[model samples]
Target: MPKKDNFDEARLAEAIKIALAQKKPNIAKIAREFDVSRTTLSDRVKKAITPTTPTESRRNALTSYQERALVAWIHQMCNWNLPPTRQDRQVGKNWAYSFMARIPAHINLAPVKQKTKELRRI
Candidate 1:
């Protein structure tokens, strides 16, 4: 199981800034002042660990551009009545579904048809 981060990223960034601004930086003091983890602040100040935003995934096999391209390809294949084969996809089995969930407006694998205006009268 992964440990949840109790500290806010913004607070950590602020702490790193304060620590770096000082002539003789006290990581522990800055961390305590900003309510961030001492070790994390120290690591960031020392450039020991690279900072990553919340949306950045370390284990992603494809970039966002690549994912969008794959979605476009899937849409194109469906339009041509030639659904992609399993061997055609290089991504994991769940990647397509997950990608759709992430950005539903971009591509919908299965869109339901709405009733016509005449059908509403019945």
Candidate 2:
């Protein structure tokens, strides 16, 4: 397997800043040239440009309530009862959603729908 490239936040931030300072930010072109995904580039730009609110910081950074709710939401949407793993336990739910969100929507696994007949049989 090829070695994975380390994604340094600082480096990404600088690249995003340069792109933004240009007359017009061509996000797709920048992503193709840099060999980074558009979503990754967009995330870096959002982080570098958007000002964080106190409530957002407090809620997203320091709380588990939101994370748990997000986890529950994802589980429901995906129709999986799979429990969170050790890494999930370590980072909490907010990180989980953040990680999941990085995956392209087109690449998602097939949704697992509940079987009403199976439930009735049980």
Candidate 3:
């Protein structure tokens, strides 16, 4: 049997962008239009999109101002109580860090680690 459709960050983002551009961030509308469940569509859109450590290095990247804005926006939009520290901003730009925090915690909001060997491999 074919594996179930696992929505990717890119697709979710596209859907969100399309919805927003159309002046409709409505979960139900987007879900129905996209033929995806409302919960799944919401989860995908809310999930952070970042690159792994090595990918970050390979990209010769630095924490851009835009990235910081994204972190701030994510905090506000998600109602994350965590402060936007410099370290948090830096780590939030990385996929591993974002992905780690994406794992549902009790609070649904927490500052992810800024550094990790395993994350570098990811």
Candidate 4:
């Protein structure tokens, strides 16, 4: 079966830009314009598209700002007496470190299951 996400990845911002420039944005119409699912377009907008695809380099690993934010969030959770479970820590580490290097540009969210699958292959 063909991959569900087979379209060009580099043009997502363009599509999003086109969608938002409308005076009265319509998700369905924007999706048709970009040849992507409406839900996909909606998600990108909601995320503000900070995080993007993953890569293999480590130079841009985690910026100091991002690291501090993550660590602070983790510590905050602890202060709340609602410490994250093992899985949450794993996710945090995976994202905070260079494992997310492969992600596309400006994408803040990580696909945990997909990362797990990649880890297994490595």
Candidate 5:
């Protein structure tokens, strides 16, 4: 595997400043000097004064503790010489749906409809 390169904007900024002061801010030359692509240097220049916030993403249905509790329940059930059957699995899934619903909607969960579809497919 090739070595991973980390962006060092602070170091690049220092080099760019010197080039700018000399009235010779060449993207290709700066990129070559910095051992990076010209596109990377151009992208740095394109960025605004203010750093942007990271994009938001969907979250899990349950918190770590809650998820662990559910997993533990399943494990206990299996160890008790009683693995859940199809119906039992459906019940467990329904219980999970209800559990997810009791929490904030921002806590994303797989819809119950998804489970229903899988059941039908099976």
Candidate 6:
């Protein structure tokens, strides 16, 4: 299964821009030109619609900004050749694992180490 969003958000944004630039915006014309939904463009122009996806979850212990800051601090620790295993003051072990999962760039090192050890054994 291919993992990618099907929605043409950039085109929709352009339609919204053109609609707003007009003195008397024509939602229907702009929608047709940009191949976007008339109702969606109109709603966006009027600021009547909210995002489909909620950015922050209610169950999260820390905010997104805080998580980013924590990641940056961890990266800095790594740059200084220091171990980055002491971040459980405000979060739990599960939170740490989930945080790693959420970040696509973070690689799980356990499996890699195991593979390396097995190769060394062979």
Q: Candidate 4, 112: how far from true, in Å? A: 36
Clashes of each: 0, 0, 2, 17, 0, 0
lDDT of each residue in 29-119, candidate 3, tens digit only: 7766766567766665555333334433334233545555555565674454444444344433576565445444653545543444487
The residue-by-residue lDDT of candidate 5 on 23-80, one tens digit each, is: 4468788777876556756665556334788853335545667666765665566556
Please give the CA lDDT of all the candidate structures: 0.71, 0.62, 0.54, 0.59, 0.56, 0.71
TM-score of every model versus the real structure:
0.45, 0.35, 0.27, 0.35, 0.31, 0.40
| Residue pairs whose backbone atoms clash in candidate 1 | none
Please, what are the lDDT tens digits per residue for candidate 2 over residues 1-122?
11337655665666687788987788888766666667888877777678876653443443566655655666665655443343335456566567566445664644455546467667
lDDT tens readout by residue for model 4, 21-64 = 77567878777777776777777776664667666345544566
Using lDDT as the measure, name the better of candidate 2 and candidate 4.
2
Model 6, span 1-122: residue lDDT tens: 21235448899899988877888988999888987777777878888334475568868877888877877877666666566776347666687688777866643323211123356566
Of 2 and 6, the candidate ranking higher by lDDT: 6
Candidates 3 and 4 compared by TM-score, better number: 4
lDDT of 4 at 119: 62
Candidate achieving higher TM-score, 2 or 6: 6
* TM-score attained by model 5: 0.31
Task: In candidate 3, list every pair of residues with a backbone clash.
Answer: 50-95, 51-95
> If the candidates were sorted by their TM-score against the true structure, best first, what order would they fall in?
1, 6, 2, 4, 5, 3
So what's the TM-score on candidate 3? 0.27
